[model samples]
Target: MTTPAPEFNKKLGFINAFTAATLMGFVGFFARHIDAQGDFIAFSRMMCGAILFFGILAYKGRIKELLAYKLSIPMILSGFFMGNCLSAYITATQHTSIANAVFFIYIGPIISTLLAVIFLKEKMKPATWFALVAVFIGMMMISGLMSVGPNGLSFGMEFSQETFFGDMMGLYSGVGYGLFLFLGRYRTEVPGDVRAFWNFVFALAGITILFIFTKPTISQMTSTDWMWWIGIGIVCGFGALGTCTIATRHLKAAEFACVSYWECVVAALFVGLLFYGEPLSSGQMIGGALIIIGGMSEVVISMLGKSLKKTDKQADAMGAL
Candidate 1:
C-alpha cells in the first residue's frame, strides 16, 4: 500500500483535530445539565467512553489486536496523563475561580509547543510562532483577562492561598494534557481507536479510585443525570477523544494544540445560545476569530511547505529520468 502524501495526512489531521475540538465544546453544556460532582462526571464519562469504544473494537474485530499489542511505557504514561488531565481540571474548577481554572488549563498549548520543539525537534517557522502568539492573546481575551478595571486595565491578576492550590491543580492539568500530546507524537504504531480505548480505561481506573474516597457515587445520580452523563461520555468521550488521538498521528503536537483552541470558540457559542440565551460579546467574537485565523494559518503554512517539498521531489524524479 502506498503511503499517503504528507500534505494529505496533515489535512486529515486538521479535520480530525477541529472536529474533536468542536465536539468537546459541548462537554460544559452536558456537565451543566448533569447534577453530580466533578469526579463523578469524570468517572462516568471515562466509563461510558471506555465501554462504547470497546464495543466498537469488538464489532470491528480489533479487540484481539488491541489485547495482543504490547503496551509501551509511553503508551501507559499517555493514558495516565489523559486521565489526570480530566480529573485535575475538574478538581481545579471546584477549588478556583473559573477564569483562573481556564487560564491555567489552556496553557497546555504553549507547553505542548515548547515540548515539541525541545524534545521532538519540530522546527517552527516564524509564521507558526506568530500564530501561537496570536492564539495566546485571543485566549486571554476569551478568558476575560483583557477586561479593563478601575485600576486601569487590570488583568484580573490576583493570587491568594485560597485559590492557589486549585490554581496549581489547573496548571498540573495543563502539564498532564501537554505530556499526553507529546507522548502521542511518538506512538505511531498504536491505532487511534486502541489508544483512545486504553486512555479511557486508565482514566476510569484513576477516577474510580478517587471516587472511592469522594462522595456522589454513581448510585447517587438521578435518572436525568445518568442521561446527561451517557450523552457526554458517548459524544465527547468517544467522538472527541477518539478523533483527537487519531489527529496526533498526522499533526505535530503544536499544530494539534493550535486546533484545540477551537473548543473555546465552540463552547462560547453553545453556552451563549443554550444557557445564557444571549449573543457573545464583541470581545469574545474577536477572540474566537483570532483563534480560528491563527489555527488556519498554521495549517495552511504547513500544507504549503509539504506541497513545495512534494513538487521538488517530483521535479527531481523527472530530471533523473
Candidate 2:
C-alpha cells in the first residue's frame, strides 16, 4: 500500500548522501591530529555518538523503543565487525599514507555490490561492470602497485612490508563496512536512527571491553589533548550519526557504497591542504577521478530509472482517476 517516494524525497536523499560523504572525510583529519590515541579517538567517538543519539531518543520519549526492538545476535555481530573496521582503518592511516588508507577503504562498495549480486540475487548493470574495472584500475594507481604517476605507468614488484600491512588493514575495513551495509540493508528492520544508535552503543561497549586488554597510555595525555578528544568526539560523533542514518535511508546499499567513495576524496583534500599544504600527485588525481566516476555512474543511471518509473506511475494514476 505504500506509494513510491516522491521525486523530491529522492533528490533530498541525494543531498543527504553527498553531505554525509563530504563530512566523513574529516575522520582522517581527526585521527591525524586528535590528542588522544587512535583507539581512544575511535572509542570516544562511538561513545559520544551513542550518548547523543540515545539522548535524542529519550527526548522523544522513545527510550523504551530500544529495548522493545528485539536485538538479534547477527545484528550484534555486525556491530562488532564495524568496530574492528573503524579501528583498523584509523590505525592504517598511522602506518601508511592517507592516500593508501583511504583508497583501500573505499573498496567497500565493490564488496557490497558483489554481495548484492550473489546473496540478494540482484543483477549487475553494464555500468556496474565498468565501475568495477574503473575502481580496480584506480585503486592500483593510488597504491603504487601500478603507478600512473608522471614517472609513467609502471608495474613494480616492490611492496613495503609496513605499507602492505596497512593496506591489508584498510582492505579489512572495506570488508567490515560492506558487512555493516549488508546488515543494515537486508537484515535490520529498525528505524534508521534507532539502528544507528545501537550500532554505536554496541561499538562503544566492545571498545571499552577491548581497552582493558590493550593497556593504553591514556594517563599521559595533557589538557590540550583532552580538548582535542572532546572536539573530535563531538565532530565525528554527530557526523557518524547524521551521515549513516541519512545514507542508509534513501539509497540502496550499493548506492551507499558508491557515495562512500567521497570519503577518500574528502580525506585527501583536507589532509593535503591542512597538514602538508602540498598538491595531490597526478596518480591520486587520476585515481580519484576514476573512483568518483565509478561511484556515481550507477547512481546517476538509477536516478534516471526512478524518474521514468515515477512518470509512468503518474500516467497510470491519472487514467485511474
TM-score for each of the candidates: 0.92, 0.84
Candidate RMSDs in order: 2.9, 3.6
lDDT of 1: 0.81
- Best candidate, TM-score-wise? 1
Off by over 4 Å in 1: 1-8, 148-154
lDDT of 2 by residue, 103-211 (tens): 5566666677777778877676777677767756665554445666467787643348768877787778878777766665544356656777878877777677767
Runs of candidate 2 exceeding 4 Å displacement: 1-9, 95-100, 135-146, 149-152, 155-168
Model 1, span 1-321: residue lDDT tens? 543433338888889999999988888888888878887777766777788889999999888978766788778777778777878898898899877888888888788889989988998878988888878777777767665346644466466899988989899998988888888887676677788888788777776677667756466678998899889887888888878888987898778888888888888776756677857666667778889899889988888998999999999999999
